[model samples]
Target: MNKKVTILNDKHQRPPEFSAGSCTVTVYSLQPWWRVDLLAQYQISSVVITNRVDCCSQRIDGAEIRIGNSLENDGNNNPRCAVIKYTSDSSSYNFSCNMIGRYVNVIIPQNGTTLTLCEVEVYGVLGAISLQTDVALGKIATQSSSSYPMFLAPFAIDGNRDSNVYAMSCSYTDYYFKPWWRVDLLIEYQISSVVITNRGDCCPTRIDGAEIRIGNSLENNGNNNPRCAVITDIPAGSSSTFSCDMIGRYVNVVIPKNGAILTLCEVEIYGVPAVTKKINLRVKFHTSEDMIDSTTRHNVFQQFQMVSALKLYWTQEPELEHENKGFSDPSPVHYIQR
Candidate 1:
């Protein structure tokens, strides 16, 4: 059916300007079986004509592409066509037509439509390099010397750079002794620098300090715990080697042999510097009878009130000597002491 469609700028029937050369015309059909196909027959160098669907269909079974043509199975043998003829430049170009149906309508840019150019680029790599290190403070033997190593993983992006290393330790026990600990970190290496921080409840009262020993001689000793200590400014990816000696009294308090099970209370790392950060350390120690004695004191005090109540006098005591004399011996004093 041949129908005349009025293209208006508003619902009030206002006619808009229709550009002459390379103008885009969009055709929409209300019929359920209507199919449309767009093709660019002629190409223009400076201008391009494109068509797109605008509105969508409300029908549940209907679907459409808003910017393209419809690819529906219609009995009509003649295929619908949207032809674009370029009147300006003379360059043949490729055109693409998307499908639209009851779900969508079409919209086209007018001849004088201004278009801007856009560009995009992407970049990526196959692999990346990373570095990591882990430090673990080991247990120090009582009245004996023990050492633990801090693991270091030296990695490189292109090449390996040998770097210097340093070790650090934090005291987690509360024992009456120097709040800080020092180990002969380096045996023969020179310390470029050292930093320490009093972590945990080790400050305000105790002066936090450390002694750096190289081989048999002490390198440095101070009361200030450095936050960032560096033996040497090594390469970009290197490590340092050092140890710390935690100086504290052994938590070995002997208990009486007859004492009960003793719970070793928390050991306090005393003498911490005032500037130390609060840190909690876990220390495992053998229990002693002193702990048992303290617990016993608590238990005895808890039953003290009940025991005191039982001691109140409720009855008079009998005089055993007078009662043994029998009724005849006492004479007039026959009645035993009441």
Candidate 2:
């Protein structure tokens, strides 16, 4: 069978080169900084920065390495992974981040400071599952705006938390005012918790400050729903569960601010659906002789005894042992998406 999947990736791209003149760059400016976008999200392990070799290596002292998804403050507002107290001549310094993000930034907080770098290397592992009673599985989902067709909303409910958008397992929205994401549970439930997996390959910080709302109202695209919880943070390549005891058919994750891009690797809802526990089906079948007749419409219910109704309750039988193949997607499109 033909299938397609986005797998984990490694550092192979050439490091970005600034080619600074040891002391010429970032001169006489407040919060002088530089940042690079990796185009997609990943779990950043560490960042390697090479200082200018020609001269003035001291200019690189006190530079901070910040890694996160947000571009606020020229990406300098991102979480500080490490800070450089000092740098020696023309060498490289490696700072461990262990965060998931798309942007890597170097910032000098001091005014009238100079920042220079010869090269910036970001090392990370890309794209990487659990069975779930997740009510949101295979449910209809949508977002404010998709960055691309490949990062549509439904992917968040596809039952995969690969955390890599390239894996086609994460949902992404474009930069917009108060960007939001929602899932239609189809029925109201007393929700207990929400499990969110941030983008592992990059930009995991984008999920912060988002509000989890649950209600039946579609006002403001379900964003005006009753508040369940406000997310503070979730590390990259990590799954954080928020306890939300609320009643609603729709669940929304909205970043209540402008210039925001919402992303979700996976959203699983858990609760008792607003329906009866037991299920029953009753039916009447036509006589075989009448069924064989092509033209006549049979009314077997009036002429014959009705069959007993079948009753069933929620339960599961032992599942057959199956191979654990790495699979994550909805419709596994074999053709490459253009």
Clashing residue pair totals per candidate (backbone < 3 A)? 51, 10
lDDT of 1 at 278: 32
- Estimate, for each residue in 179-287, the C-alpha lDDT of model 1 and write its tens digit: 2233322212222222222221113112212232222322222223322222222112111223333322121211112312211111111121112223222222222
Give lDDT tens digits, candidate 2, residues 49-110: 76665567677776777777898777887866655645353377665444567788888878
Runs in model 1 deviating more than 4 A are: 1-169, 177-180, 184-187, 200-205, 208-338
TM-score of each: 0.16, 0.44
Give stretches of model 2 more than 4 Å off: 1-132, 275-338
lDDT computed for candidate 1: 0.22
Worst 10 residues of 1 by lDDT: 116-125
> Model 2 — which ten-residue stretch has the worst lDDT?
329-338
lDDT of 2: 0.68
